[model samples]
Target: MWSMLMRKFRRFPVFSLDKRQWMKNVIHQEVGKGKRVIMFYVDIVKLTEVENRYGDVIAKRVLHIFERILPHVSRQVFEIRGNILAIQKLWGDDFAIYVSFGGDVNEEDCRMLSIHFQEQAEKQLNRQVSFVNREELRVHIGYAAISGQDIVKEMYTSVKRAAHMAKYGITSETYTHVTQFHQVLAEENVTMNFMPIVHLPDGETLGWEALARGPEGSPFATPSMLFRYAEETDTVFRLEHICRKRALEQLRYVKPQQKLFINLDPRAIDDPFLLRGEVFARFEQYGLNPYNIVFEITERHAISNYAVFRKIIEEYRKKGYLIAVDDAGAGYSSLESITEIYPDFIKLDMSLIRNVDVDPIKQALLETIVQFAEKVGCKIIAEGIETGRELETLIEVGVTYGQGYFLGKPDKGMGHASGQAMNFLRTMQEKKASVREEPFLFTPAMSEILAKTITVEKHVKVRRVHEIFEQNQRIESVVVLEEGRPVGLVMRFALYQVLGGQYGIALYYERPVSQIMNANPLIVTKDDKLDEVARRAMTRDAYHLYDVVIITGVEGEYIGIVTVQSLLDKMASIKLEMASSANPLTGLPGNVQIERELNKRIKQQVSQMVIYCDLDRFKWFNDRYGFETGDQIIVRTANLLKEAVMRCGSGDDFIGHIGGDDFILITKAAGADELISFLLEAFPLFFADIYEKRGLGEGAILSMSMAGVCMIPGLYENVEAIAERAAYVKKRAKELPGTVFLDERDCAADETHQTQV
Candidate 1:
């Protein structure tokens, strides 16, 4: 049964074979073409021992199996780079294979390739042959880069010598790593840790990124060290599979709506088992949905042929498993990988996210990346967010999600951001979300007004709905259910169409209530914003518009309902409260709320700015121009303050009107000067606009002045102290020329000058 090639090889001795010489000449010719040839020299170790123990028959059979194994392994691993140029036996049980590349060998690439082929080859042979254990069946693997430049320099000749140098270049430490890594892969000595990737604004764990850890208390405990060993030993796929299996085992505990991110090597696509849908079976066995799985293709792995690789992963994408590119900003291949793969998520590098608050260049780069990610329909997940400032900056720059030691560390079980980090995110999130038309800081959801809704299964008789409605007059509506999800709505008035008629009760009472229920009633989630839910509810047609809005949890399990009556009442109440609290003219926060806001900011000990704005000639103009014209002027000043705050300050900034011609603005200390400068520059134009609007002659003049104080920690405990200081500064500011801004520096200079006098 031996193949013709095996029978032919037996006919000639090593020296008589013309193939070896022919291969060498072909390689030299390739080098002459200015291409680099990577030649791998492989031979079976202890071949004579196998012959001594099992006789020549078994030894020859082992040789045949290894020859078959070589080609298969080449197809799996070697095909990534290119096809093997030739395979020739140099001597008995000794062989060599050559592959050509377009460019010279990179030292790093060469090192990785050598370990990859050698370690992976030995593993494959032991697995296929099974004649000996992994240690017993050793394959001596060596490789060399033969290039035109090296040949011209006479640096490399005799493929055996060149290969020996490349092979022996590996240090002794690699042997220890190989031994340790082989043990780890064989025994699956690894554990998985889960870290939460949180939504930055709410700190919600959108998904858990699985991190692989080696045996505890070992040198390989860290992922970098453990994976390094795997790389040196050429067991990346084996190691990746073990980590993957362990992570998937936790899928039973993960919610169906939450995702579990698994690290994947691009080379994993070459696995025959994966191509045959083996992982899909694993997911089915775990009772986990593939929709909740995400495969992270690390940017560290270099893809040789993206055209082919792209087609391979299309199957996984079609199966509802999302893809993420990790360590995006740390590698050269990140942009290419993003463009080629168009992944669902992009995990930014730790280096780029660290200290991003202070680096304008990094901020600009990240902003651009965020925009690019948005354009490509991918969400950005910033990694290694260690500081509060970094978190705030990322949110400001519009990175949607993030994870780091500051947010949460990896844990044995799924975890969330710690309480401390949660408070930080909550405060910042509130501040950022503060720019809204609603009166409250956070929007109320449908749950706020969820009514006690009655429910009956769809198969129930219509008589049941009638009984529930009769038992409780306040239960205006009943939700028809199939399983736990709502299928239709039955209202008190809907009963009239059926039961109000003469034969309505006897004819329809015994049938399924689904027949009488409104098949397509309004249904909103419990967490939906109340305003949006109300908008949707009000838009319904006349008959069903007043019907209850069925509220459900995120998974569509029916929770309760919000009647149109209660929803409108809630909306009216919110409007009434807003009307009472907001200023009549400017519609900004009034005196009571401004005092409360300033006191709260003072107690928080945060660095901020309190700006007091006033008009110098306003009293004279108000007396000459009627109160109506003066009101217009006050409104114009309020508009000017809003423009400065909106253009320069953050969303968390506070603006208020203080009676006749005075106003207040609170913003962060960081941009206080810029905001003040913008107001001073624009205030003069606004002042002129007021006079021009009334058709007043050019002789009229109005002067505007603003006083700003930078409030650092312990600067003032109460709003009274801030008000008194700002009042004095405002008095000083009114003494200056038109449109002037005075800060702590100017106040200090005046006090110093007065003391010197």
Candidate 2:
């Protein structure tokens, strides 16, 4: 067998009995022509044990089986050892094989051949050697390949080293005995994609988050596998370089204001030769601003050498690059990293935002983060807003920016930035204004719009005042109180653009709020009609009447702002409360209210079917997009869910948002399937444009797969549980490529177990 011959090749030279002189002459001539020679040294350690167990006869038969396949796999096995051929099999289960290759042959071929020989040898042995007691047979192939000019002994040593690697690979289970080792590398391929992060306030997309993917149909189909491959080959640095370059090249299509966020393994900072300039050069090639490329460094790995990392990060920052501490507050020393880096932005971890509305502890922590961000001149991006309730909580906590699936799912092309919601905001403001002749004016006695008056020391930062102004929007004007005396009022607009200007923080730091605060601003009594006060507010000059501040008592104390929009919103709320049955986000009545309405219809014996809605990868969106933008996404999606329900809704129809990104609708059961069909068709195209806008691609193609579960009364208990199950089924639907799923009625169909193609 080749295994026996390989060992002989390592320990002794082989010369043909009758043709030794001729073979030696040929070998010398080949060596003279500069060919490389690899001598394989194989030792069959199990041979003695095999002989002991099955006697020599059965062992010899197993060897004969190996001989049959020897020629079949000889070319590959021989070339893999650098063209070495087995001179002969030897005693004690040892053998010798020699392969030689000229300048024309690649060394890799010999490695491949060696792999094939081992696989065939193992398979042939396993199939034929029953009496040999397979476990007793162990063989090792050692080879050293070197240029003919090198001494044979040196060549032997080199080949032996390679054999060690092969032995290790086998023992460690890096490769199956029957599988070619080369195929392992061939199987792992890396793929990449991107997700958009849109800023809600201005509808300007902020950046794209580069996501890692792997080869389709390959076992290595996720970032984890790609990384594992890199680690295995010690080529992680090479892969990062490639990923960075590819992501930058793709950034050419992004909007100018938008940035490209690429994740960096912080451990890479210790790599002395990592080319930082090469990265910038790629950006230059694509004409992208260095400032627009933000590196999101995750803290999942411990940063062992802080001094080195700090130096490298500082060097990058000096070159107009921005740094963001991703997943802040998620792991060890997250806040410490933020403080150390003084990042331009802090991305709150999604876990902190999940179900935030119901968690008081979470709200307090978030508020603290916001306050700290204000002090440090860093913007806070809350990650993961998936429900209206959560959005409302974030808004109340003074968070201004966020992103999540609730905002918009990542797509392969262009998608819109909720065009309908923007238009709705503009339209509703006007519609409500025109409908009421008296503008639904509210007297102070009926409205509780009082504000708090704060006295600050003269050395307080103007930034602090601005922070207070931004957070409590109800404060129309601030009366700077110093030593119990009113020094001045701070105009809101003056502080607005200041934060974005040069020296903004310095100009406000350590300065009295009075320095920038207006003096003797207009004052109004709390007893005035709120709508009438809003009308008066429009006529005042910028300086003379900073903003009308209403005093709850006499002597012009501080109170909340009374605007026309607020009055209209308040009127709507009153109407909603009087109705006492609607969802706050989409203004639909509560389930109890809905049940009454539904029962009324059912009592009349009207047919109805319930449909559920759930956002797919909504969590991923929140993780990528901060919670602020996520809220906008949730609010918009809630409206869209309502719209979809209404489009198919009848007098017996109902819609609701089940806390987060879950929804339900009850309609005529006969037409319920039709509603699912309509939604399945419309949702993707409706949102694809937004993805394109964010530069994921030309026309955003969302991966928000959806599925609906038909209402089966006995299948679930109560309306809440029914809605929960339907939404759960919808989530399973979203796992597939398309956007729609309806739980099939066939007995053979199970929506939950559907596969994604």
lDDT of each: 0.75, 0.56
Model 1 root mean square deviation, Cα atoms: 19.8
Q: List the residue pairs that clash in candidate 1.
A: none
Instruction: Score every model by TM-score.
Output: 0.47, 0.41
Best by TM-score: 1
Clashes per candidate (backbone, < 3 Å): 0, 67
Model 2: per-residue Cα lDDT over 382-443, one tens digit each: 77666656755775686656666665555555343455434533443344333322211112
Give the per-residue lDDT of model 1 (tens digit) for 1-757. Answer: 5788785454222332445455567667877877677766677778898889888998898898887777656556665765567666666777766777666555455446656776777787777666544245877665556554434222223353433433433435654345455557657989999999988867877889999999888768999998887776556787888898888778777764467988888877555444344565565455443456788888777888999989766656544457888899897699899889888888999999989999999999999998887566677899999999999999999998899999999999999888988999889866764454443222356888887777899888988888888889877888888889998778887675546644456656787776556666778887676767887675443345678889999899999888888888998876676579778887877787788778767866578988888888888888888888788888888777776776687656788888888898888888787888888787767767666777877556777788888788897878889999999998889888877888966898989999999
Scanning candidate 1 in windows of ten residues, the lowest lDDT window is: 149-158
